[model samples]
Target: MTLPLNPQRVSVDSISKIKELSGENIKACMQCGTCTVACPMAEEMDFFPRKVMHFSQFGMLSRMEDINSYWKCASCHSCSVRCPRGIDIAKVMESLRLLVLRTNKNYIEPSQIPKEKLKEYPGIMMVAGFRKLTS
Candidate 1:
């Protein structure tokens, strides 16, 4: 879904936080689509990497809030490696995740998992899930 841009709605604080967390110049992104092409999880994302970067550059945090692009990012660094501007896109994705996590809202709640399902899941998988989805 494409969100209409309103300059008045931009949050400078959110943009600063993303930059501080990622240590990447988000504005350096040229909307080249190179990162989108390199991302392995691009096909699974509701908003592709390029669009994510575009929204981020404009400080459109609300547009990003409900999207699965950041969550789906594998953090394989393929996008970073291929970026002409040398932006670490994976770190940006991590920063986005961190922003949500800082709000104390978890993507998954461990306690909500069924005991039977927990027992069926692998130990490493559970650990990884907790690390990724929990605050």
Candidate 2:
């Protein structure tokens, strides 16, 4: 007996885990391309919003990690609003980013910056920048 080739099924465990982490129905996506079309920064992504959705649905965890789409996402909610499946795509992107951020790897450290530059920047800017850079 031969099994049918289906890349999506190969990583069902990953799909389920991602769904649990993101709190979204990973199987609800129908690959309508609406998310990619509605994304404001789609052009900047290595794999657009729809492709990232597919990556999650298909349990392609390695593909998901290799792509830079999650980082490129602007969290504008445009894709989420346009999704026919009503999936919160922004939250999915947030989950992907969180997976990377929560691994004890801070993208930036405050001490690395010069005191003069830190003082020169506005308070709100520093706060927001640190928020994105640290965690």
Candidate 3:
């Protein structure tokens, strides 16, 4: 089996900017995998929260881009709230999510998202969009 390779040319300044914004000392992360286990979405995430840390730590932020799990994050702050390294993992995920989300110009509707909905309806999505446009 072959593994996907991360792009080789990620910018250090971008990584630094992410770290600064997230308030996470990426160097402190030891990739202990504890955050992955603690995350409720680990089983479903293509790459766990810890993997996102590693990618950003090594300047492989390119691959971590557009990872669907990122959008799924409730920002429950569970990973950040539990990380032994004391890194703000949730903020880190949001930082990355914002990076990817900001890339698009057109608005995507809740009905347009191509993912399985856990609930009978997308209450969170609807509410979030409503609040965004209203406020």
Candidate 4:
């Protein structure tokens, strides 16, 4: 059965932005639930991986903030491997992270880090860590 979509909920610009950032065809997702089944953190996620894809594809961008399930992804590539459509589910999650981070909404503050530990980590690690934590 097909679900009806509200025109007001559809954001073509946001969908295009996600596609551009992740290099994915969001419309290609068939909502088969393979990604959810493959997600190791599925039980922990509020929406699971498959639902996250649907939220993006369906243009329900506002709901993404409430679910925030993409942050729970461990980037194990299990979902990508299981997806029959070959969607890079991991990249999709990253795109979501990037979208949030680009808005300057910091989830983690630099002051929260220990200065000594930060010094020990490599520059790339620090930057990547902040990117993940901040978003």
lDDT of 2 by residue, 1-135 (tens): 111123334577767666877899979999999999889899999998888888888777667654668777778999898888999999888777766677655545788989999889999978876776466
**CA lDDT scores, all candidates in order:** 0.86, 0.76, 0.67, 0.79
Candidate 1 matches the true fold with a TM-score of 0.90
What is candidate 4's lDDT per residue for 1-135, written digit by digit as tens?
111223246677778788888999888999999999988899998898988999888777777764557777778999998899999999898887777777766656888889997888799977876768584
Overall local distance difference test of candidate 1: 0.86
Instruction: Give candidate 2 misplaced runs (Cα > 4 Å).
Output: 1-10, 108-122
Per-model TM against the reference: 0.90, 0.77, 0.73, 0.78
- Compared with the true structure, what per-residue lDDT tens digits does model 3 show for residues 31-129? 998888888887778788888788878767667654666656667777887788899888887666555445542234555655665355478766775
Q: Where does candidate 3 clash, by residue pair?
A: none
Give the Å shift of residue 132 in candidate 3.
8.5
lDDT of 3: 0.67
Give the candidate order by descending lDDT: 1, 4, 2, 3
Runs in model 4 lying further than 4 Å from the true structure: 1-8, 113-128
Candidate that scores best on TM-score: 1
**Pairs that collide, model 4:** none
Backbone clashes in model 4: 0
